[model samples]
Target: MSSSIWSSLPFVAIWSVGYWAVHVPHLLFLSLRNTIKPLRPVPQWSYRLSMGTAVLRAVFRYIGALRYQQPLQLTPGRSGDRFVRIAPPADANLFRGVFGAPSAMAKPAPVSAVWSPAPVVAPSSSHPSDGRRRKVVIYAAGGAFVTGFDPEMSSRFTSALVTSEHFGATNLLFVQYRLATRADPFPGGVLDLFTAYQHVLGLGVAPADIVLIGDSAGGNLVLALLRRRAGLLALGRNNSRSGGQDRALAHQPVRHHGRAGSVLGVDAYRPKGKALTQEEEGYISPMDHPFRLETPLYIEAGGAEGLLESIVTFAGQMADVKGNRVQFHITEDMPHDFFVAYPFIGAKKESCEALKRAKLFLEG
Candidate 1:
């Protein structure tokens, strides 16, 4: 009826629409939370909590009222061996309206007990030879327990030695291990790693001539296996020779190359034996495993990553070992997984340099 009332009608309509846009997702999240009530406790709850937090943050951000900054610091009293739980980024608006309502929680399915063989890319004949066959290098990828191992993130590091300029003559193998959410923690992935290593060794690669490469979590695995080898040696349980019937096979060293190198992708939190409930940290942490051999090691980490503390601790332990040759490379201002971010950040130059350094370390 009145012109003023008519003009005000549009403003009210816009406000109503915007309000629902912000609140509807929150309502759906509440419904999802209810759905998770009957499921067995699994790490999947972590994923749900993360999603919920993201959605809530988005609603606040959309309203121009959310002000939260995730502290980059690690939790106090935690050891460097434990995995860090990072709070989502402060600007959580990125997840708004992106997810659907959580359905009935899926029944906890039995995780496969069988270990699958690690994927091996066939060696190309074009691989140059340095008079003698170059030693093979196996790479394990690092995804802070959740991400990575897809075609893009893994292919580069797995194929680096064979595909890249440095050490292209050398054979390379990429071992894909189970991530945190998919399987029971700790030895689950480690056991898979052992199986893969054994498989590779069975394929005629000499333990003395093989080199292992891993970054971040994969780095942790490399150290874990080495420690297991030492423990086995101490107990005289290094039964690697028992399975081989041939005299030559019986005498082969239990471990390939007798050494391995790891590139530590710094983590934010370090579990000091008691920091977290995760089982992997209990036995596999470099902090808990003493370096027993003169394993030539190359340790590298980005200066800016929060995991530098863990890297430093790992290096210190390795350095204390008698007869160990450990090289530490700390790059300036490179974020976690800088090399893998090459496609998105145009960091190929920096990544190439790091890869070059890594190749040199492995070769030497």
Candidate 2:
């Protein structure tokens, strides 16, 4: 009886191992398929593979199956190219936190080439302020810490603004920043942005005269600067023709002013709380900063972005503040970074309208 039991134990163990081996991949595949079902007309095979990887990553994420709590290391390839070793962070909720770890600790291999500054559109000699026909405007493009900053991505708005009937002859200083990846983390790009802002500020333009315009991530930075008084937030209260007042009201939902209003007022319109701890929220959030409301600011974001909560929250906070002057343009049905896809299906007529509104808000 003892011998039979021993033999049976081994057989059962083997069978169990085999059963899991056979089912695990299928389970992972099914989970991936179900997750991506909403994203159909499921492209070609390569696209499917990429999407499948993204989906599987999300699956591993939802169940908390990952072993590592932070991003994996990257290593240099044969040709001095950097390659990430572990799978990219899954697009799960925890993915951002995991990927948000400092790049120094993560030890991603360095790329040989450094990102050079985008060609600075020099202020034309013909600026009206300088008795010339040109105006110098700063353009900050937005991405949710991950993607974008390509020339094509910025061209739609920049080209139009530089050549528009309203904003024509305006020279653009397009500020391009780094992105968060397995290599780069949060605040890496944001720091670069401040450097760019300071560089522009050093160019002798008064903070009040500089028209700062940014969308999405760039918008967040603009508001951050405004909140920090790194520049200003031009409130549209002065001009009847300006759209800033309307946008500010629409961006923030009004609540009764009360005892809680001080804590939860316009300052709450920023994207700092909820998912973040009090300390983390305080450190990274623009709302936590002080402001002077010096420059005319134009900020916009898509209605469908997850960050809309923070955007509206920060906007509300700004609105509640006694002297902060900020304006917001919330475009409907627009997803995060929708402007990057200009001339694509997502760039609806409303984008044009938003640009027009932005131009008027800035030029007014």
Candidate 3:
């Protein structure tokens, strides 16, 4: 029988405690192993930071499985990138949140990225104040499509991109979609994002000036939205969009496919141990079909990433498409969505460098 997220609360609580108790040994092993790996040396705290994120992620997915109409505290303020109610433009969709982490805002000209109580309005296709052609980044946050990573993490990502002078982005429109659990399946969530792409077009932002950006599963969604004709930049799943983790086998999160199955949001399209329905299998292995992605792409993964091989394959295939301009970036020793986890692990220097490289991609 199906259960709403409300019914899953006790499990979330118990599992969090239980998982952490046993996760300590694996955490210690990873820390020691990571030390000898060829990846850049950051603070050792990153091991805990990554594991804690994984635990919180599992819990968030459980919470996100509730029906959309449920009485839950999932407003944008509480949502952490999980929700932003998008009604008709005339109804004035309510979106409220400040952009950028305090650390991000501390940089030069962070004001360019900060806003609150901002409505989803028809933005000028160019900077009205300066008459510069607008470059809009349609940002899709990554979280296995159940929950978002966190507000601060997303804000920091936005801050990094927006503050980049090289990228020259005038405005960024974050996409809102019914998550996998709420939408109840694959294309359902993708459909909502397709509408978001249309929304940007309606705002008079030309397809050429628009850039699509996503991390993790969100990256997969960006690739799907490419049929809409926007420039694409993503931290892709190995064939999975922002898969959160790789196939761990007995291991935890060893592989990320934009790919979640044994755990997390996979419960939506795939029930445990059951054969995937046609729709579910299609989503699980998207590259199985051919897509003519004419939009320019900047695909990336961490050198130490579990999703590395798949990401490489996906990017390679995209490059094979006639006239596809693809740029693949590999950040040495980084983990999946390292930029999102960097701040937590005190990797500010690396994060800034990443932003600079992303600027080059956007500018190209």
Count of clashing residue pairs in every prediction:
11, 16, 18
- Number of clashes in model 3? 18
Q: Give lDDT tens digits, candidate 2, residues 1-364.
A: 1234345777657755665576677656664664564543233223333344444334333222211122212333221221212222232221133124442222222211111122222265653234333344555554344334444335445556444564443445555554444333434444444444444444444433445555554555555444333211242223221112211112212111122311221232223323545433432445534344544545566665446676666666665666656567787645444454444433535556666676676556
Model 1 stretches with alpha carbons more than 4 Å out: 1-134, 151-153, 156-158, 235-282
Candidate with best TM-score: 3
User: Which runs of model 3 end up more than 4 angstroms from their true locations?
Assistant: 1-84, 88-120, 123-132, 150-153, 228-263, 270-284
TM-score of 3: 0.63
- State TM-scores per candidate: 0.51, 0.48, 0.63
Model 2, which residues run further than 4 Å from truth? 1-134, 166-169, 181-186, 201-209, 228-283, 287-292, 346-348
Candidate 2 accuracy as lDDT: 0.42
Query: In model 3, what is the error at residue 233, expressed in angstroms?
Result: 20
| lDDT on C-alpha atoms for all candidate structures | 0.44, 0.42, 0.49
Error of 1 at 234 (Å): 3.7
How big is the positional error of residue 1 in model 1, measured in Å on the Cα after superposition? 56
State how far residue 7 of model 3 sits from its true place (Å): 3.7
